[model samples]
Target: MWFKNLQIFQLKDTENFSSTDLVTKLPDHPLRECGSQDEFTFGWLPLIRNSEQWSISSDLCMLVRAGKEEKVLPTAVVREELEAKVAEIELVEGRKVGRKEKADLKEELVFSLRPKAFAKRSDIWAYIDLKAKLLVLNSTNAGMTEQLFKLLQTTLGSFPMVPLQATVSPSSIMTDWLVKNDVPASLETGDEVEIQDASEDRAKIRFKSLEPLSEDVTRHLEQGMSVKNLALRWTDKMSFVLNDDLTLKKVKFDDTLKDNAFNDSQGGALSDMDANFALMSLTVRDFFESYKVWFEIQDED
Candidate 1:
């Protein structure tokens, strides 16, 4: 429920449809995990396992889960077994196993082992923030996010979601902010920043324990280095470092989040879990808005 990383998308369809419109359309496209009969499965499912069809709250947030599953048979392991079988067949046949025979044997081995192959699953929690006009996925990987985008499009008829782009480069704004030592009022500068060389190799440097962000960092900034990461606090709610690609890492939610989102475990565990999910959904929305405001202010400046 708590999105560890935010990959934002502008809801291009917002003008024609509202969040309330999704409840009807989304349920039909529930995720189907990959099965023995199928090679792969990827789609949207209710966040809860089998219980709810769609998880929507009064806050205008819609919960849709992205599930991807693939049958995993390690190629190396398969090849080792195949090789041993090929050798035994060659010895019994009193000749080298020909290309066609080896191929057939490999196919047989794969079919024999596939049912025992482990299934790998990737489930990412995602939400559509109707109020913010954004769809945020907890996944940082572009491929998985694109899968969600496709799922949304398939479910809703058309979902024109594009990766967030800013008028001003975040790298430039972050570097300037560091240079001036003028971290924004709502943001408290943390003790790290990552810089990468602008050369062809794109050498990267990560500086930790640089509390004041001075000396070598200032010199590197002067030397045409680009800021690839910046650490900062969002007032009192949380602290995190922003990567060059604008992904979040090492997020630490302050007490406000823990208290509200997780509430003290007084009620039955299931009720508490439900409360946590709701609180987390709302918290994620508020934080996104706050971060957007902060970045937009910088972009404007």
Candidate 2:
């Protein structure tokens, strides 16, 4: 129910699509059971539990899923079957099977096994800040987010999503933080850090959670190595390993943030879903706002 990570994108123009437009186009790509020939399917649905569609609002949230069906007969299995068939052909014809004949046998094996393969589905929830003109994907994987992006382009005739990036990688900022040997306000450095050399070989240095920079970390910086991963805590709200790409990994929110929404003020039987939703939404909304400056500057140019 909570987003673990975000692959952020900003909407380009409001004139191209509207809430009504999304409502009209979304139903055209509803989820369906995978067919024998269907390799993949994409569609959008409700963001909340026990709902069927998106509601018009300042913030537009939707659940989208992509289903893929693949008939993957293992190479080892196919190889064994092919070997047996090749031997059988050789024994019957009094000669070895040619490469072309072996390829044909493999194709036939796949045909026989196609009906037994299983389908796998992956679901991603997305939030569109209609007022702010932003799209937030709840996936850290670029491939998964791009798949959904392409699907939007296919269904809507246009998709204007530029990934949120900074002109300077977060690594540079982290390097500066390390160089100054100073902790920034409202932020505390954790014991974990990764410093890598800027060369083809890319030599690396990793520090454990219980270890401090002390001397080894400083020596790497002196040698012009850059920060690849740094563990940091943001004002007791969450602690995360911030990557050079500005992606947060191993993010954990504090209970104080959760307790406000999941309250039991009325004898432990409170319908606090809306409260939780509001708090989570606000928390996520603030998360974007906190990082927006980093991207906005780069986007402007």
Candidate 3:
């Protein structure tokens, strides 16, 4: 599947690591369904839906999936039940329910409800880019990404990675781009932009479907506000919103590229995935290379 968001990390000393090694180890820790009382569970899953393969590996990239299953026990429902029990006990016993007893009842209520509670499931897609030495995940959620990191570390014994840190602040550079109306030749500004004042008040402004270098955008830059997020098109092949923290949001590959991959697959599910992965990996690798140059990231730090 196409990645929609990016949380990129720099991986060090990966030249000698075998991508197949990671794939082989994934089966040792396949995702377990949540137990009756478990709040949540996380584990590996097949990269392709309904397929047995846990990973799709190539010399340049290895794609994998992690799944999270959680019980959806509503807090309000639990609180309502607890109150009813506490009231019944208080009335039946002709006494007030003690604090400790109330807490105990709530715990019992939650434990009883967990099994019947609806299960929520989601998947996180991540890939190891051997060419770029980057671990990119299609999630911006801190908790989800951390779970992936922890699982990888446990499964492989070592996952030496750190959040991508560039030599220059992205906001600062984006601000300069708007002020000068001089975007890098490889990238073209898109219609959406978010600017925020640096002052403590932190006033933020968002513009949609307008030129990023328009008079209004430049005027905001003139007012001491800097770019917090900006939508950008990369070499006419992909588009995404680049955040100040360097995370990518709203990522999308050009439809032409997607169409080509689909046509090349000749209409089989597994072949489709393979084609998409191959094209996506190559395109993203090129994007990352340009990103490093733009941000002056000479090497992983």
Each prediction's Cα RMSD? 4.2, 4.0, 2.1
What would the per-residue lDDT of candidate 1 be over residues 240-285, giving only the tens digit for each residue? 8887566677677776767774564467544555566666667666
Q: Put down candidate 2 lDDT per residue, 1-301, tens digits, no spaces.
A: 3456655667787566766676677767655656665545555544443465343343354334343234455678878888888888899989977888788888887777666666665677666665556676667876667777876887688877776667667777787778777656756788899999999999988988544356778777878998898887777677778788777777767789778656632322223433444455556566666665533434322
Show model 2 residue runs off by greater than 4 Å: 45-108, 264-277, 292-296, 299-301
lDDT score for candidate 1 against the true structure = 0.73
lDDT value for model 2 = 0.66
TM-score of 3: 0.92
Candidate 1 residue pairs that clash: 31-44
* Residue 23 accuracy (lDDT) in model 2: 64
Over 4 Å off, model 1 = 18-21, 79-113, 262-301
Candidate 3: the clashing residue pairs are none
Give the TM-scores of the predictions, in the order they appear.
0.80, 0.78, 0.92
Every candidate's lDDT = 0.73, 0.66, 0.89
Estimate, for each residue in 52-76, the C-alpha lDDT of model 3 and write its tens digit: 9887765678899999999999889
> Among all windows of ten consecutive residues in candidate 1, which has the lowest summed lDDT?
292-301
Ordered list by TM-score, greatest first? 3, 1, 2
